[model samples]
Target: MTELLDIFRALADPTRLRIIALLREMELAIGELAAVLDQSQPRVSRHVRILVDAGIVERRREGSWVFLRITRDGAVGDTIARAGEWPYAPREALVIAHDARRLAAVRTERAAVAERYFAEHAPQWDAIRSRHVAESEVEAAMLAMMHNRRLGHLLDIGTGTGRMAEIFAPTARRVTALDRSPEMLRIARAKLSGQGLPVDLIQGDFLDLPMAGASIDSVVIHQALHFAQEPDRVIAEASRVLRGGGHLLVVDFAPHEDEDLRALAAHARLGFSDAQIRGWFASAGLLLENTETLEGGTLAVKLWLGRRRSDEDQPPVTQEGQGQRKRLAA
Candidate 1:
């Protein structure tokens, strides 16, 4: 009862309630929240602290920036939703409507920042894009491969330009795009935010995904695996988040002698081989279902599609466990 009281007390304030309503729309950093609320940073931080202490909101630190989102555990979210059901002053709605307009300005600011970054790095990106097959053809292949199944809770790993998230968001039940670079995440956020798609852009490492095990249905690592020094660990991490029978799509370059790419482009590996990827899939409890190759300029792109093994497809116990069970029975 005391805990419930604390939650109510924390939410009793109009500023805190407004914060919750804005968060319900999308996750925002302290600065962005302040911009939308038309409040100072310190004041917003105090309100955020109250909400955090009450366990109604959670904060995730990415680099130097901290972002806030409504808590997703248990009935806490439902409780907040219930509170929103209560009658409020008519002006509250109008205030929120005004906030929505301010939010548009914030989005415009984000796009401008992202555009500056893209303009600065356009040459590098264009060089990389020229070596590979046309993105339109690759996207078509990807769509056809997964069109047969529903992408429940899709996770786009290393979502660079947010293209994959944009392509798959309409069909996915839930979309979350993760990238290691803060600048890239901002670029992705700008592209995804305007579409009215509920995408959570997270700044996180691919080797250690900030997601629970067996929670994601579809995972895509498109043209990003080459940047990882330990690609096997990345595959393992992707497999870890996949539910039974979930799909993992890896689109990257096949074997090549592109030493310039490693020296100039920051690529950890020149490319990958079919045998190596299959070995990784087997070790990660994923079955290699399909493989497609697109031959283009100097680099050839390969797509490996793997499916996580379901419980019905795997043994109930390991060999050692089974042996121990037999000895105990005897």
Candidate 2:
């Protein structure tokens, strides 16, 4: 069929295939897609239009910008699977090698673009931080949950800029802000210290926190869980530091069909769904008190509120064969 041939022709190019791979996980604006492909905007747009006409990609408008993502068509999936088997002969290997080099160069350019973006925005992070947080209902719910809790020693995991910590410190006796980035910690320290709040700054990984067991009365993680290399281990660490009856508040974007975030953010997994967060909490010896979906339109946020049970009441982790009861100690 002419349509089928169009699909094949669109995918025959290495650049179009790379775009398909990127769109398989996350929807991207045309400019963002262009940046990733290291191609001119017009060239990327033309390729995307070809793929769209072939029913392999779909476009949606968000405000003035248009986003592209893979179509949810079985035929498209089949086409992709079949295309995976294009046998490249020895001569074709040279072309593949050339393309590999080209892709590497493109990645370097994209990385430079990302670096410039972060660098430019880093200075004004505080001014715009609230805009990002305030836009989400999940953030609001998490803030309300923290407000209602009788927090004594609060620990904010991945506390970039101390935004959540500064918010919690006035109500809690003390707030400890932890982050892996020294630059981010410096910004957080400046923000929290400038407020004259009782906030302690620590630089460390969330999975391997420097805090002692049962040291914190509350733990808050805000839009940062997806960036963790080991989310389960980080949750376990949060459980370990939480005192009995302590609360854990998590706010993050719900999992979308985006694979690019998984690759770009070093995300071990896509953002958590409600069921996944609940399971993680149960495994960490924490009881789920509430889970809610915050309406943020296309950027849906999920909030999970959990409480640690009494230390002795925690579940036991069973070994595969030994049948030994290893307390699910965080």
Which one wins on lDDT? 1
TM-score of the candidate numbered 2? 0.55
Global CA lDDT computed for model 2:
0.73
Off by over 4 Å in 1: 1-3, 79-86, 315-330
Cα lDDT tens digits for candidate 2, 37-118: 6679999999899889888998755335565767655777776645436675666556555545544444455455546656
lDDT digits (tens) for residues 184-222 of candidate 1: 877887777778885778889999999999999999999
Q: State the displacement of the C-alpha of residue 76, model 1, in Å, after optimal TM-score superposition.
A: 3.4
**Pairs of colliding residues, candidate 2:** 25-257, 25-258, 25-259, 26-258, 26-259
Q: TM-score for candidate 1, please give it.
A: 0.89
Q: What is the lDDT of residue 128 in candidate 2?
A: 29
Residue 288's lDDT in candidate 2: 93
Among all windows of 10 consecutive residues in model 2, the one with the lowest summed lDDT is: 321-330
